[model samples]
Target: MSARIQEPRSGGEPRRGETLIQQRNRKIILCAALDEFSAHGFHGASIANIARAAGLSKANLLYYFSRKEELYRALLTSLIDTWGVPLTSLDPDGDPREELLSYVRRKLQQTRTMPRESRLLANEILQGGPHLEGETLESLRRIVQSKTDLIRSWSAAGRIPHVDAPHLLISIWALTQNYADYDSQIRRLLGEEADISDTPQTFLETLYGSLLAS
Candidate 1:
């Protein structure tokens, strides 16, 4: 069996200054872990690599995260937290088309700017999302379900076409995330002959605008 990893020594309680430092350290470790995990994936990534990327010793890195699974879970949790907002912010009080388009824009923006993080999460899921299956997955399901409920309500009110809510959300996720997850293939097919940065955004907007138009 693999040896168990050690938790931080600072224990459950920390002083005000210590808490601040802990937060800062955890933030750095998380960022470094993002890069490492994104580049090398979970099994290929290591404490030494993360610590080096974060400019800390392996022991110091462990001070923030108890083990590799702990660190990986933190990274996935951060991705969920960062991307959860667009879904949660879908206002029932707002126009359905605008709300969904706004959500599409936010998701596409993450693909454009934070592609590594996007792929990292996608990779985890492709491998069955073991670490992402617990509370993190539960929280995501709740958010998606709540928004899907709003979409259903809108459809019932004759605001949007009566489409399958969960399937619609899945389609939106696939369309937006494909750019990040398949970026290499996409860029290769397009070659250097095209400027593609803003095209995806416009294309997505138009596509959803037509699909969700009442």
Candidate 2:
């Protein structure tokens, strides 16, 4: 039950200033929570189950997270940080063709490596994104708008063909993330052992290459 002890924090909140051990424990708890939530969803999951998966008691988990919602929010925050990496790497100063293609490659790589996180975000959006409101949503909007503006600038400079910046970004997301969000359907339709390797990468690069060529 992982010693089943409670640590005091301000207003029973998870500590903002965590020690090394606390950081390690928090990471363990979030990892376990991700698996549990991704499999069963928010309403279907329980703190007790996550605790068991993390080798901690329910109370021990609460000492770190306070509530299931908080834990879920933390998980989403971590996933957002990961998802932002590829988007944030888009360099307006770089060649438009290379930058956009690199973005496609990086996004596809995330789908392959972080399938669970991608599916988790998709599930949240399917549920109307109750947890993804307010500041988190605003932050996302700002980041996306910045990239879209960058894409528009590329078009204005005649670096790429005239394209709707927002929809182009949306299409890239839909195309790349389909592998993660619809893995089961894709696998069932293709084969049990179907491995989507460089096919999407090659096709997308070719498609966008033609679009981005000045």
Which has the greatest TM-score?
2
- Candidate 1 residue lDDT tens string, 51-149: 987788999878767789888876777677666766888988998989999999988876777787888888888878777767667887888888888
Which residue pairs show backbone clashes in model 1? Answer: none
Supply candidate 2's per-residue lDDT for 145: 95
lDDT of each: 0.78, 0.80
Backbone clashes in model 2, listed as residue pairs: none
TM-score of 1: 0.86
Worst 10 residues of 2 by lDDT: 3-12
In candidate 1, what residue range of length 10 has the lowest lDDT sum? 1-10
The TM-scores of all predictions, comma-separated, are 0.86, 0.88
